[model samples]
Target chain A: MTSRAHIAEVFMRGLYPVLIIASFWMLLRGHNAPGGGFIAGLMAVAASSAYALIFNSSKASKKMPLLPARLSVSGVLVALASGLPAVFQGLPYLSHPWWTLSLGGFKLSLSTVMLFDLGVYLAVWGAIGGICLHLIETIEENL
Target chain B: MILPVAPLLVPLGTSLLCTLTSNSVQLQRKISLLGSLLLLGTAIVLGVQVADHQSISLASGSWPLPFGIEVVVDRLGALLVFVAALMVLICTLWQMGDVDPAHSSFFYPLLHGLVAGSCAAFIAADLFNLYVWFEVALICSLGLLAQGGTLKHLDATLKYFALNLVGTLLLLTAVALLYGATGHLNFNALAMSVQYVNPAIMQAVTGLLILAFLVKAAAFPFFAWLPASYHTLPAPSLALFSALLSKIGICALIRTLSSIFHPSPEPLLSMLGIIAVLSMIVGVLGAAYHWDLRRILAFHSISQVGYMLLAMALSTRAGDAAAIFFALHHSLVKAGLFLCAAMIFKLSGHYDLRKVGGLYAEKPGLAAIFLLLALSLVGIPPFSGFWGKYLIVRECLVQGEYLWAFLALLVGALTFYSMMKIWLEAFWKPHPSAGWQAAKIVKPIPVTTGLCLLSVIILAIGLFPEPLIGFVNDAANHLRGHAP
Candidate 1:
């Protein structure tokens, strides 16, 4: 294994929490703002990749919660399933069905569009993470 | 309303399901076969609906037609989708016995993705949506072509990837230019706005778009990647590629020429015709020099595409009808031929005609099927290919383009020669070994059943051309902007 700089490892350890929170923030604001599924997914991937860089890939992969392919498959299924409810209601495919909720004087808006975005988030994250991990492993092996 | 989008949805959903179930090969195969059948049924229903109403257009997000993505099912699109679904079904069934276990996990997902992309491209009514679907199809195909992970497969995949990227870049540039010139991206809206755009800008856009599609379609001068790479992939993948990938390009060409650039400029028509003729001649010539069965078929695919494009170049209702008919017929026959080649490779352990022989004596049924598909491909009478070629030649004669008609016939004859060469070399010659007895054949049922199914379809179409002729004529009229 390649030796990691002590300072860099410490910095990545500190950065993970911030990155995760930032990605979720981006995901939530994505519907009305510039930040959405794609950007948020990239952010999450950046965080994970940073972890891989700081530690070795073998250790990092064991730490991962789900396989990248499975994550992507579930993401796609969720996105596709989100579209189904609208079809069942006689709306067109991917037609957003929205509802406004009152939660203790606060308005909470929910819709299938956000669910689709979330699915995209997971799908993109999984695809990029999986590819990055594979490449890193190959490079490490070559080294 | 839902019918317009069902074809795309079925495949997309199946692809996702396949990805989820990629761990189990048997399950993946079963799901894919079921999905293809559902898709075929959906396509047929959509065809009938289109016939009843002339066309069906659905805005995917329930947005207005101009702003939302539109999926339109007309006679031509429906017919192509139905044929594509059928081919996918056959290929999936063939894949059961053909695909290696190592590749099975990802193959079905990629196949479904490709099917979805092709179906979406066929019905896409917006320029950007078409581009999206093209990317989807391209990525899946690249994955498939590289599935074997051999050095040669990797090299072919790289070439395919690079050339196709260039094509996609050119298409994007053209779409951008078109949107800038007309300020519309939807097909119907663009058709209206294009008339008012500057003629020179429109001409440039048309040229670039045609060039991009030609590269994808693997026409002459841009077709080297096809022959270089297609023969290297696994048989079932090759069969699927033969059936759908280039045909998608042809479908796009037909759609663009008839709808977006109707009343085509004289120079454009002539240029397309020249390309068509060259593709036909050059493709056949290339095939004549190759002794590999798959390589020959790959070259012929280029030649067959030329016939479809030649019909489109005529820019008349008859031309449009003939182009659609030719594309559908060629997809089935070419795919059947590839599947047969796969069977030959399976039985003989070789793809080169020089090393393979005596198939006529050993496997008479397989030999007969090969003859039927090959004869059809050569445009012999009482075959599906004959009807398509007859229509295009007749249309050319009607247009007083005797040179084009003559060239078409000459290409047909050359195609006949190459097919005959394969037959003589591979089937008629005695087996090279003195003690040649048939080894125990393993699982011949799927391939045999698939070949027989294709043969019956080819024969039925040949014997009763009236239904397909009338259907394609209606589809042609629709392309001419008439509500038949």
Candidate 2:
């Protein structure tokens, strides 16, 4: 199931880089803005799905950096662990504890809530991507 | 403070852990069992705490009520959670022997996921959060249902998934409409705001909500999916599904009816009453016709749900108490019966009574336990089911709902007939085939011990029901928006 359209492959190659950067932008700005983990995760899924479509799903899956199941599991663990400090502090579960750091005169704010969001990001990306890949493979096999 | 969220945290954390260690079958089982025990412990402690405190509510992220998700553990919620946790532990023990090791990696995590979702559903104080939990439970159950990946499993899962997705959509629509109408989604907030909403609109929203919940609860008109899909799975999964899944729907119905729409419109109440009677009759008739053990039990689950809905229809404190008591009793008796049925399947290699027999002669202990559980389910005296049914009948009679009371009694007798059919065919009749002789007993000890433990609990509750009755009364009072 190799790509037969060179234009389609070229288009995907150009689109994916932009999509990945947009997804990161969405994730980083999600906390107080309109975009969030879910939308950003969808963005990432879109990029990969497009790439798979042009390059053939089997080859893309072979070259994938991480197995979707492992990614999703780790994501869930990270999300769950993000809540532990609150329990230790005698607060309600999932209560966020925030911190601010200045590195090289650049200020950054971090919190358990961000970690939770990041976890959701990874989870959604992996879950939907895995499902898409599976469906594509099944379709290919049937064809 | 910690108690309010312990039930949720234990299961969620365990599920994630299980998922992480899915490669190791032994480790997955150990973690899952340990997590279930911890969940049970937390549930018991939470129940006691709620009993003493009247009700416990916690808002996640310290967000104030009406703005953030709330988890409230009142007497009834705590009781249901505790029972669910117990069932989870027992089912996990049964799973040790029942589940194929190849499937354990998926089974353990999904089981814990289901537990977490059910616990969340029981305690959720917001309409949207309840929907979320319902979906969570549905997703996990769907995964578990499809774990075998056989043609039959896939078929059942597809049907179950499709119907449940429709129900979920309906529920979400109702939640959206309610939020639009009342501008509040939290149970407490809705209770206060609902009174001000226009009556016609409120009724419309209530109808939508009831329809969604009834579908989930497997009431008469929408119950076809239950019997079709439930009997297709393994016995341990069936046991869990029987014990907790539909009951969550019942819990949601009771909570919604009592908290948000108490003194439910008389017409709606009567409508529900008629539906309840139809469910009872249809469910029992279906059970009587089916010869398969699990199918008969599945049909009975529908009929038993009818009894609870009947109590809900009464809309009185006594009715509420009876409903709660009946729900608790039904979960225990039904789970025990399903586990027994599992053992029978193992011993006889057939769920069909026509092909299986002589259980009494082969395993008299199992036969006796099944008899006791069946009798309890039939509402025999000195069994826990009797008190629940008696209370409902009494409440109906006192409320002058004689027709409902009579129908409930009639259903009880039919339930008896169906249970007797199983007893007569499987236990009393001669063995139909040599399969019983060749059937291997797998992990008989854990399975038997779990069944016996549940049976003892049933008998203990039967013998001394005053404490539970008192608890239900308190729960009823709370549901009535009164201080206990």
Candidate 3:
């Protein structure tokens, strides 16, 4: 590898973490604002994938907490499970009733809809990231 | 009744769980099997409930009817869902057999995904939701078609993809146009508000939608993808594709035409009739030309779909009833015949009918099961196809469509000839390779089990078709609104 490419990789290695943190911020703030799971997930994917452009699939994949396929499927489970409470409550599925926890250390406002959004976040991150990384790796192999 | 969405959710949930458990093939397979069984259980319950009640619907997020994610299960939808779940379960069992290919590890997800999508398409109460479900099914089917990992499979996948992508695009455009013209995407809302919309816009937009569905249905001129791609799948996956995929499009057409586009669109009427007839004749003729087993069956799928489309296009109570019966009968019989073809290939070591023979002398039981399935495909007496064709022809005659009636009968004869072609070449003639007594080599227990199960279901439906007939008639009556 050239020195210029090496320098690019080092730059991306630090930038990737920042992008992921920004993605989470996007995901969390998604409920009240315009930003949501899909855009945040895309941002996260863009982060890992930029590094992958300079490196290999394995190294970039390791940056993910869960592998792409697992992340996507686990997201599905979470999303579907979020709807389960409504079934038990005899409400429509995905009713997303708010659950508030005002405790000493934590002031949390959670709902199944939030869980669903988080699931969507993880799912989008995994599926798109997987596709992008695979394509990039294919290009690298051919080169 | 409260859980109208259960039928849709079960298979999708199963598919996800299977994907999540992909680390252990055995565990994944077992989970898949359990999931399909649960799906079938849910479908059976839903079917019975819908049979009792005329219809059941649910809107997610506790939203009002028109603006929510909605699922509705009428008798027809419930029946199709039951059949889809059954096919998935059978295919799951068949895949567990020793006949599976090396790369079949992906089969679980694809099968459940396809089933889930079909179920969702059947029950989706809104146009955009239906499109989303159809895409899910389409993507999963393409995955199955391409999983063979060969150049030929890639070629087939591209063909299927290209055609389906156009259909999907057209569908999206139509939906967007309709929603923009009238601010409703729900079927009931659209149906109510469509009359107030401009006739020109309705005609053009609904025309596009019907044409899009026709492509998805593999109606004439859009059917090339089916024969090209379906031949690449293994038997289990092929059976599910043959059984459920096109039927969803037919059902969608029936739903939209009968409900939303009541009285039918002006110019599209005769055009749909001509397309149906062409599909019938062209499909059987293509089947006549193919010696490969899957290609022949693939072509026949187009023909059978034609029958259902014709009946549905009639837009009468009896016609809808006949269409529903035809869809149900054809799903069972076609899947049975495809499974039997797989067994023949297992016993004879070839899919080409020209190269294989002597099954009648060696394995009479196999020959007999094939005969029942083939005969059903041919619309013979004492089988479900017989009634399916009879109702279609009778409905055509009643509609003063003499030419369509005659052509349907002609296609039946042609279908018979194709079945005979398979029978003579694969079952009757002497084995091309002498001293190759291949009958005793392998029994294919799993395949024969599937074949027998399908045949018995066909036989039971054939013998006791009164219940199905009544149910479909009721479904048709319900679709026709309060005047039944």
Candidate 4:
């Protein structure tokens, strides 16, 4: 409505994507350090919270309808799938075996741990984001 | 090793898959039914494993015992998993007829979620893991209860949520305190660790845990949440809830009491006995008073659970075996009865016993199925409930606890009275509405077929109690041998 308000909204909008990117950064760094999927999920949700304040939930939801439910379902599958390779290998579920690939003297390392973290990230993102959006929508409906 | 987790995986994966495919309710229904079949297959595989090896335990993350989550399928857990699968499969079959796709997009997912939680709880080998599974079951139950979205449903869900939340919090706090005091969460390891801990702290933790389990089990004084919420559920959901939900709590109590607190501390055993007696009396009386078919069954659930707890309170080998058999018998017969009730509703358009009748003449086949299930529930001869009651009464008599023994028989008689009340009112009496005969449903073979299959299973278990009794006795021994 006012110039200052408009300026603040624009600034917050720019910070939103940065926060989204940082959530992934945190998720990636979580394996060996202080951050992980649950915290990363909070960060991602923080961006959405900002967006909900700036805009309206109907618009936000229209931009990505059914996103929350999909993320949650797919996240669960991803997580469940990550545990299967080990079970097939005659080890316990979620044993987190690792693998490495060499491409022209460059090595890429991977582990079930990261896949699991990704699943957790998506699941937490969806659950928390969906809850916030639902709450906001309910309030709007009541008003 | 794989089999230990397979049962949990099937249901969990199926639940999430159902969620992923929620857009097409018909497709979701098919997927979920397939999931139940898969779960039953997994349960069979795991059952054979448990039969051969006695117990299969897996430590998540490949960590050693006491360091990671332990998932174990002993004979009792394996058997319960088998029944849980059977109940879900049957309920899914019956619910497919009733659920409207448009409003029930989330039903399949929630149903599977509930089953997954119960399966996980059944097989969990450690305290914290059991708590997690219980929470999962609790959450899914709340979702399923609120699915109808009526004012009564919200009211019921709130009652359930409020009370169960307290129980859950107590369970968590108890687990934390146990971990803090004993430095172990694995049942086997904790059994060893508790030896060096102060008896007072151990007693406090055990009391809290038992109280939490009682609340979950719908045992006396803490059982108001059950009838308050359960009558609000649709018949299929009610059938599933009656079959699996409270039984998990009973299973948990039997496990925790036998494995960790066997040779239970002073006062707890008597306390359990008191709770059991009160639950039986109160539940049967309440069932007699309620006319709604679902509420009657719900109250009967509390009473039947009391029988299992009564067996547990006996603390003898025979007592433990009776408890396990009683649980198995109760799940099968209760689910069958609720399905029969659903069919009656379909035919007569009512759940109130006072309002509906002439079912015996309208559908003789359904009448027979209902009669068999009700007879089983009342513990008549040559039915599954007969064996459960026989074992408990025998154990009580053998133990020379005449008061409990007398009360057990008295409660059985009262149960028969209430069940016969349902029979006379719902099946025997003339239809109150003049046109009730016009609305009779002859199709929906799945409901009757499921009930018939269930009755046959109950009859088979009754006729050949030797094998199941043997299996349950083996499980009872396994529980005792868990303690260091």
Give a tens-digit lDDT track for model 1, residues B1-484. Answer: 4778887889988898888887888888889999999999999899889888889988977998799999889998899899879888887877766422226589888988998999999999999899999999999999898888889989999999999998999999999999888888898898788889878888989999999999999998899889988888887788889989998889889889988777667799899999999999999999999989999999999999899889999988899899999998999999899888877777777889988888898888888889999999999988999999999999999999999999999999999999999888888999787776654456667766777888999999999999989998888787768521
Per-model i-RMS: 1.5, 1.6, 2.0, 1.1
- Sort the candidates on DockQ, descending order: 4, 1, 2, 3
The segments of candidate 1 whose C-alpha lies over 4 angstroms from its true place after superposition are A2-18, A31-35, A62-65, B98-102, B482-484
- Give, for candidate 1 chain B, the lowest lDDT window spanning 10 residues: B95-104
Spell out the clash pairs found in candidate 4.
A30-A35
Compare candidates 2 and 3 on lDDT and give the better one: 3
Error of 4 at B74 (Å): 0.5
Off by over 4 Å in 2: A1-26, A31-35, A50-65, A102-106, A136-143, B98-104, B433-438
Report the error of model 4 at residue B99, Å: 8.7
lDDT of 3 by residue, B336-361 (tens): 88888877887778999989999898
TM-score of only chain B in every candidate structure = 0.98, 0.97, 0.97, 0.97
- Model 1 interface CAPRI class: medium
lDDT scores of the candidates, listed in order: 0.86, 0.86, 0.87, 0.85
Model 4, B208-306: lDDT tens per residue?
999999999999989989999987777668878988888889889988888886667858888999999999999999998999998898899999989
**Best candidate, DockQ-wise?**
4
